[model samples]
Every structure is written in C-alpha cells, then in structure tokens.
Target: MPLRSIQSAIYTTTMNHSLLFTRFTVSLILCFIASAAVAAVAADKPNILIVFTDDQGYADLACYGNEANKTPRLDQLAAEGTRFTSFYSQTVCGPSRSALLTGRQPLRSKGWGMPASEITFAELIRNAGYQTACIGKWDVSNRKAILDRMPNAQGFDYYFGTLGANDGGRVRFHENNEPAGATDDMGSLTTLYTDKAIEYLNEKRDPEKPFVLYLAHTMMHTIIDASDRFRGKSAGGLYGDVVEEFDHETGRLLDVVDDLGLSENTLVIYTSDNGPWNQPKYTDRKKGHPEGSIFWGQSGPLRNGKGSCYEGGYRLPCIVRWPGKVPAGRVSDALFATIDFMPTFAHLAGFDVPRDRRIDGIDQTDLLLGKRDTGREHFYFNNAGVRQGDWKYLKPDAYFHGYAIEADRKKVDELYNLKSDLGEQTNLAAEHPEKVAELKALMRQIEGNDPPGTSPIQIK
Candidate 1:
C-alpha cells in the first residue's frame, strides 16, 4: 500500500496500547486503596494489654488500703478505671496462670501439669487476626521448656522471658523458644520486663493489626528484691519497695501507650496471680532476707494467706481501664476471677471459646462493660469448697497446705457469711445447715466425674 496507510495503522496500534496501560494502572491503584481500607478496619479492633503480677496481695497498693507502701500510679489507675473488690485468682502461681490462660479451674487445667492440648486465650485471639505476644513469667508449662506447651505452640507470635517463676532467686530467659540467658539479679526483672513490653508496643508489633500483650511480671514472688533506686525506699520493708517499683514501671508502660495514642482503644488489665506469701509457714523462706524486711505481703482483713482456701489465698486486687468503655473510678464488689478472662476475651475479640472441654469461666463482658453488676453466682475453690451468693462453705477436711493447723480442729464443716464476716471469724455452719448442704451439693456438682490425673480432693 502507500506510506499514508502505514502511518495510520501505526497510530491506531499505538493508541490501543496506551489505553490498555492506563486501564491497568487505574486497576492497580484501586486494589491498593482496597487493601488499605481492609487494614484500617483490622486496626480498629481494641488492643488488649494484661499486666499480671506474681504473688501480689489483696492490700498491696494504697488504693487497696496499704498504709506503708506508696503506689500513687496504681492508685491513679484505680481512680481512672473500675476497681474490682471481689476479684480472685488461684491459691498459688502455677494454678493461677493456668486458670487465667485456659479459663478452667486447676482441677480441669491441671495446673503445673497443664498439657499441650490446653487452649489459651492467645491462641483464640491470634487466630482472629490479632498480633499476640507474651512477656515475662509463663508458669503454665510446668516450669519445663516443653516445646509443644511453650508460648509459641500455645498461640503467641512472640515470646520473651522465663518459662517459669523466679523461684530460687533466679530466672532463665527465652526468646521465642530459644534460650536467651539466665539471671540471678531478681531486682532487674520488673524494669526489664517493662522494657521488653515497651519495645513490643513501639517496635515489634504490627501497626496494622490489633495486639494482645500479656506482660506477666515475676516480681514480688518468692526471694523478692528491689533495684538500688527502690531499695529501702518504703516504710513497709523490701516487699513494699518491690510494690512501689512495680507501680512506677507500670506507669511508664501506660505512659508509652498514651504517647503512642493508644489510650482510647487499648484495654488495660492489672491483677495478681495470687495473694502474698504472708503465712507464718513462710518465715523460714525469709531467713536470708534483710533484717526487718517483712518479706510477706499484708492480707488486710482476710483471714489467711497463700495456699489456704481462705479469702486471702484466692481474692486479688484487679483494676481494668478502657476509657469510655469501662466506667471510670467505679468500685465494683461483683465476684469475678482470672478464670473468667478466656470467655470474656472471646466476647470482646469476636472468637469462640473451646466447647469440647469444660470451661469454668463465666463470660464477664457485661460486668466489665458496666452493663451488669452481678458476676459468677457461684465460684468453687478447687475441689475443697464452694462459695454461693454471700455464703461460703468448706468441708470438714478442706485441704490447707500452707498452715500447720491440727486436723482435729477441722473435724466439722465450717461456714461463714462473708457479707458480714469478711475476716471469717464467725462460724455459721451449725446455724445454717440447709445452706451448707446446698453449697456442698454445688461443690460436688462442680467436681463432676473428674478426668484422670486431677486433684485428689474430690468431693465425696
């Protein structure tokens, strides 16, 4: 053909190519915008930060009536959130951690014997598209470095700190299933754990995904100590010093949350694993401590301390802060426990609690959100006793591991109306046999056909 005909063909082909390129570019930009919107929606889920302390007592903070230990930061936290007056954990550390993680009683979770099969809140929340991290003591693996039962296998994306408690005045650290190092300087843990948590919030976590940071501090457990700046700084002795240091470090963590503009969307929970080791039996354990250190924590009006089936052993100080969600400065006397967390998180994070096994935790989202004041009509204490409404009943042979009371003295079923007798000084079992029988029946019902390898104190 002619030169004019060839030029026309070339122009038409070139124009068609340009149109295709423009359409492809527009499609790419639209895809990018859609991905960004999805990320924003995921980030809208609330962040959960749980600061769990070891062996802290019911009255360790000034907000809880501690006269010697100064805890202005925690006092302010209580003032800024809802303080739970009838909160409870387990009688000891391992059981408490297991209960908190599995939302089951020690009888079902198996405490130190918690198997790899047990599911944790971390697993469920992480599966629901949240970043999960566990920092500090993890006593659920029976203190062993069991790979299947460790944090990584149990659903945490990042794991730092010890697999167990700082028992023996030392702890060995692990970062994501690998050994990091060991430390005997017990005083360094509070600050160190807080630093790790801050690092996670600032650098490690994914910005586009909501996160769960379970910072379980190991301070105030057995063989407690305080750093140089905190030592001898309080009137309540070394234990008091540790408590004050914890308060300051927690304040620092909260400040970082504020600095990152996460205050409104981050749900902060501060609670203890169990009550302090304040019994007379712990006297020998404090032999090497500084003179007049008063290593044990005060139980306030509670009758006994850790390892007893009494108020002090189970009751704990719990404060929750989620601005504009949980009512500020409200003090609630509703009965709740660490075992309730799994189901509550399921409600908040949009996940399902495990249905194959028995879960002892009642969903407490209503209580936390201030929609309801009543929580847990009945809470069983291991297999030894049970509390219903205001009445708590203990069998004649309820196990007491920490104290040295004679067996003969406990020959009769004891009962107390905790509403009026917080100290448990009055025994109302003889006057209220009907209530005793009712609670005993509830305890037996909770005991249920126990699976093998459970606690030996099954209700008869």
Candidate 2:
C-alpha cells in the first residue's frame, strides 16, 4: 500500500481547504460593499425641519395679508414654496404640539404631554434611521415626573427649549431633561433657539444620517419681547417688532441650509401653534403701541383671536418650502392640520405609520408634493366642538373665548358659511338647517358626543 498514495490524498485535502477560504473572503467583501451602499442611500433621504411659531395669526405674515409688519424672509419662503390657506392646529400650544407629534388628537393622547402608549414622529423617523431634535418651546406637558413624556423620552435625540410658555417670568429652559437656566429676557429668545438649531445641524447632526429638527419658536405670544436689533425695526410696534425678528431668524436658518448645499434636500416648514392672542388691551391698540401697554397680535379679517373656537384661533399660518419638490409661488386652499405632519413625514421617509394606535392625521404627502390640490375633506376643530368645510356649525350655546350666547341664541345653533363669510358675520343656521345637521353629525362622530364646551378661557 504505500507512502505515494497517502501523500497524494494529503495534498488534495490541503488544496480543497485553500479554495474554500478564498470563496469565504470574497463573499465577506461583497456583503460589506452592499451594506455601505444601503447606508449611503438612507443618509441621502430628505431632511425635515419644522419651524413652528408661537401664537402667530393666519394673516400675521406679509404674504398672508399683513402689510404693516414686514416679513421679507417669510414672504420669500412663500414665494419659494406652497402657502396653505387652510392649515390648522389646536387652539392652544400644549394640545397642538401633542397632536403634531403623535398624529392623534390631544384629548386622545394622555392628559398633558404625549401619552407613553402613543408612537411619535421622532421615534418613527429614528427607527427609519434619521436623527431627531426638538429645539424650542415645548408645551406638551407641565409635569416633571416622567422623563419619557419629555422630548428626549418621546423621540427626539436632542432637546433644548422651555418646558412651557415663556410668560409669567418663571420660565425654565431645559436641555435634554436638565434645567439649563432661567429664561429671564424673552427678547433674545428667537435668536438663541435659532443658534441652537444651527449648531445641531452643523455640529451635532451626523453627516451619514438624515435629520428632523423641530424648531418651535417662542415669539408673538403674550408677554412678548424683542431684541434691541429688532426693537425699532417695524411699523407695527412691539407686536410687529417681535414678528419681524422671527422672520429674520427664519431667514438666517434658511441661509444656513443653503450654505450647506442642503436646500434642495431639506424640507422647511414654518407655521404657528394657533391664531393671534387678541385680548381687551390689544383690540383698540394701534401699530405703534404705547409703553407699558400690552399688544395682542392681529388676526386680520378673521373673527376673534387665540383661545376662541373661531377661525382665528385654530386656523394657523403655514408655509412649506422644499426647493424643487414643492412648487414655488403656489397658493393652495388645501385643508391640512398639524396632526397630518406625523404621517406625512413618515410617508416621505419611507416608514410605516404606527398601526397599533388610532392616528387622527391623514397622509398629506401627495398634497405636499404637489401631486394633489386638496386634502382632508373634513377637519374637526377640537376646541370649537364643530367641523368645518364650506359650512361651520357651532353647537347650541357653544362658548367661545369668554362670551356665551345671549338667551335668544342659546337654544339655537350658530352656522357660518366660511367660504362666503370668512368673518363669520352671518348666522345662516335657520336658512341651512340641513347643512347644520350634517356638520353636527360629523362633530359627534369625531368628538364622540362631547357637547360644545370651552377651555377655561385662555387670555393672551
């Protein structure tokens, strides 16, 4: 039997082993290349930046109909993208932010901040591999127990802003769950928030990942202030001065995006939580408000201002700019809401909307992309106890702001045709009872038989 046969077998075995090792190495290299390509594609996904203003009225922006307060940058934003005529948010900040984040009605979520059970847009986008940040006034909750209820816990990777309103001189600014400091001077707030947002984009953001930056501003609301640079800048007085500075800061933020060559790939959205805060003092005030006098923001032709269930309260001023994606200089009458943003962003990021919970927001991706002209046939006004379209029906003795209906009007429903009567001067309830019934049915369906009620009369 022989040494020759054993040597041949050993040589064949060694050759086979070498061939298998070479194949395995080649396979590993191909897998690494494929994984890198996938990451690159994910990084190139469009960036979403929502610049939400505080208590800005529907007609506050110059392009929105204000000729007194100059908003060149915001006007330019409208010129560069589609301006929505019928965008909505809740009547107040807390509910509005919750609705925007979770795609559910604020009442549907937990008491104040977003419920732990709900899935946030941040979490969804992050799951799809995007960086998330909330960099402004976050009024979702006043509670401090649950860190998970905060932005850091909800979904945002970074949180740097005030927990609640900037009024009362007791506002505490927090950064990622820790108290950063007390925000004494409200005048420089817009600039500070903008700087932080830019820092996140330039320094904190990962170059290999797409990001969502929610820049919620703290301006135009009550107890307002403006930096010295913007103090005497507008003809509309103190209110006008604050608005102008907000516009300037917005322009600065946009400039950063363009300088970074990310304009085309970034989606910039500018809007407000609700309408203007027009109280007793602000009604008779002129453009140049006197010293020590409070100035409530204007709502142009809309009836009433913030905290009321009227059009001026919930119908927010909205501007969306996405360079080539959204058509420039296009004005749309599409009905949209802040709640819609969660689903819309998820759609754009190629992520699935959470199916485990009830999401009130409808997908408005087609409307934003200019593939459609209309969206959301019916929009429920949470504060109003009414549903709007062409016809708006107010429940019997529905209380708006602090004014209740007189005895004669208490038993009767109030109806207004928003299309023909934007100011809501006429009550066509008796004339259009059928339309009243239709809207009432819708109100009950959406709000679950909750009779028309007020929200403790928020002044300013």
Native-referenced Cα lDDT, model 2: 0.80
lDDT of 1 by residue, 1-460 (tens): 8999999999999999999999999999999998898677665568999999988989999999999999999999998899999998998888999999998889888888789999999999998889999999998888999999999999999999998877677789999999999999988999999999999999998887889999999988877889999998988888999999999999999999999998999899999998888866566556545566677887899977788788888899999999999999999999889988988888888898886777788788889989998888888898569988799998988877745243335567989999999988889999999999988888997888655333223111
- In model 2, residue pairs whose N, Cα or C atoms come closer than 3 Å (at least 3 residues apart or on different chains), thus clashing, are none
Each model's lDDT comes to 0.87, 0.80
What is the model-wide C-alpha lDDT for candidate 1?
A: 0.87
What's the CA error at residue 181 for candidate 2, in Å?
1.2
How far in Å is the alpha carbon of 309 misplaced in model 1? 0.8
| Candidate 1 lowest-lDDT run of ten | 451-460
Which pairs in model 1 have colliding backbones?
Answer: none
lDDT of 2 by residue, 1-460 (tens): 5899989999999989989998998999998988798767765578999999998888888998988989999999999999999888877778888888887777676435566766789988998889999998877666453676788888899999887885564467889989898767878899999999999989999877888999998887666889999887788888889999999999999999999877988998999998877756444443433365455777888887777777888888889999888889999988888988887887789888776666678778789889988777777776455655577888765545442122233546879888999887898989988988888877767766233222111111
Off by over 4 Å in 1: 1-33, 285-292, 403-409, 450-460
